[model samples]
Target: MTALNSKTITLKQLAKTIDHSLLTPDLNEEDVKAGCELAARYQVASVCVKPWDVRLAAGVLAGTDVKVGTVIGFPHGSSTMETKVFEARKAIEDGAVELDMVINIGAMRSGQYDYVRKEIHEVVEAARGKALVKVILENAYLTKEEIARGSQLVEEAGADFVKTSTGFAPTGATIDDLKLMRESVSEKVKIKAAHGIRTLDSLLEVIDAGATRVGARSTAAMLDEFAARYPDRLG
Candidate 1:
């Protein structure tokens, strides 16, 4: 994998790493349709839908190279490991190519590192070779030590990616968390900065800190603002 740098990759390349999200609880068919259209228009990597919408998202993106991604254990990682594994398998069967599982924050806070690591491993194992697993740290609820420890545990558990936040937390990805995660994992392991990262400055900070992927619903808005301010750059 390539490291984050000032040089921009192609839209196709950028899209390949993005998980275009529409995770609101009140989402409907219309919202999914709009999300799919925007995802295709932006050439985003995947459309991250709710579990029930995975099949719908899969059908909408069937003819395109765009993949389907879904959440497991959702905004909170408080679900039982058994339930999370079941959700992961079911989502893959529903045509999801990527699985973002929320880590059990409660367990981590209790210093049950083994429990946290085991939970991540269960989902990863359940994903089998069918779906890529991204473990969400929900960084806003965690301390620096917790972030570092969780990143390491995620690495040890063999997840494909370690993510910063769920966007529902009090805070989201920070430069410190991204830097710590980057320094903790191997080059092959990917790092994603999500939540509360809506501006170009913050994005650049995380990217510079070594986050290869970013999860943001405001990507389209941010791109529009960028194009307006730097018309020449858009060319």
Candidate 2:
């Protein structure tokens, strides 16, 4: 593993760390298609799209190294576990290789740890090993303690990544939240920072704080700036 914090690595390695986001509700088919093209061009880690666009993105990204991912329970994580599970299966069937599911926020805030944990486990099980599960803590709505607890539940449920936000929240991933989440889970679990990583500086800052993956809307600007600043590392 190239140290996650190391700046001396291939542009492809750094690009692989970004999950290009195209989840805005107003985006239509053309927008998604163009986004997929850009993702392939950059060889991003994945493109997180709305559920309906999963198939489209899957089609566009076929034979490319970039993966397809979609969200479950979305900006708000209040859906029934059953619905989320079904969504997980549907997304996988539609060619999503990664699933970013939000934890039930009300349940978590109520300290319903069992329910939260059970839901995450079921969603993972729903994937049936076909997709990687990234549990969104939606840190914007959580207290520091809740964030820590959420991180624990995500790992306990066997999810691959513990993510910070859904990007619909008032705030997004913060360095403190990333550090805390990184500390909360064992090394087996990865941290994904989303919801405010807009610049190369911010992206690098989050990785240094312990994010192995990030959700970013400013994908081109960040990568272009990176290439400019580190031409020597564009291997």
Candidate 3:
């Protein structure tokens, strides 16, 4: 992987790559608000809050470049197709500009490729161009071949991005997984890395591996480090 010139990358550029994640189940309304505030302050790419918070987050991030994003079929992708579509539609109506949807992991692992593809396609259709759809493959439960096949399915379904994990899985994004996903899809399909990205070095590793976006709860610490290293680039 070719390295990103850390010296040349500004804080704004790095911030734009992050989706400040606030998906923990125990978080309250105040927590969501604070997370949105943090995202606004740093001007990150988006704030990926829980589905219920999409309207609130949208209100907070209005007029800013920071987009409002939410998940569909979430940590587990067992939800029925109709439910997932409804979730996507409601999120979009609530001002979510991005939707990170989980694929049917059990079905995918069972080699139900057609079912998985159809589900993703339905969700994409439901978004109706209102939001950029990201299909999460949950790589922790899949082999390399499955990951590759899943990426292809996402591209075929017309989703905007292929993602690594749901962060509720046993493990998160890896350099190898990111590279494999990148190779599996064309340049038109972007890649997002979520979970366990806690430091500047780790974040850069994923970026070099081909991830354009990352989901993380450690936004402040990571950006603070970048600020310390490149004070002039802060924006």
- Per-model TM-score, in order, reads 0.92, 0.98, 0.96
Error of 2 at 133 (Å): 0.2
Stretches of candidate 3 off by over 4 Å are: 1-7
Poorest 10 consecutive residues by lDDT, candidate 1: 6-15
Write candidate 3's Cα lDDT for 1-235 as tens digits. Answer: 3334454677888999999999999999899989999999998999998999999898888888999999999989999989999999989998998999999999999999999999999999988668999999999999999999999999999999999999999999999999999999999899999989999989878888888899999999999998998798876
Which candidate tops lDDT?
2
Give the true-structure RMSD of model 3.
Answer: 1.9
The 0-to-1 C-alpha lDDT of every candidate, in the order given, reads: 0.83, 0.94, 0.92
Q: Model 2 over residues 1-235: C-alpha lDDT tens digits?
A: 5567756656888899999999999999999999999999999999999999999999999999999999999989989999999999999999998999999999999999999999999999988669999999999888999999999999899999999999999999999999999999999899999998999999999989999999999999999999999889887
Global CA lDDT computed for model 1: 0.83
For candidate 2, report its TM-score. Answer: 0.98
- Each model's backbone clash number: 1, 0, 0
Give the 10-residue window scoring lowest on summed lDDT in candidate 3: 1-10
Q: Listing every candidate in turn, what is its Cα RMSD in Å to the true structure after a full C-alpha superposition? A: 1.9, 0.8, 1.9
Q: Give the CA lDDT, 0 to 100, for residue 22 in model 1.
A: 90
Give candidate 2 misplaced runs (Cα > 4 Å).
Answer: none
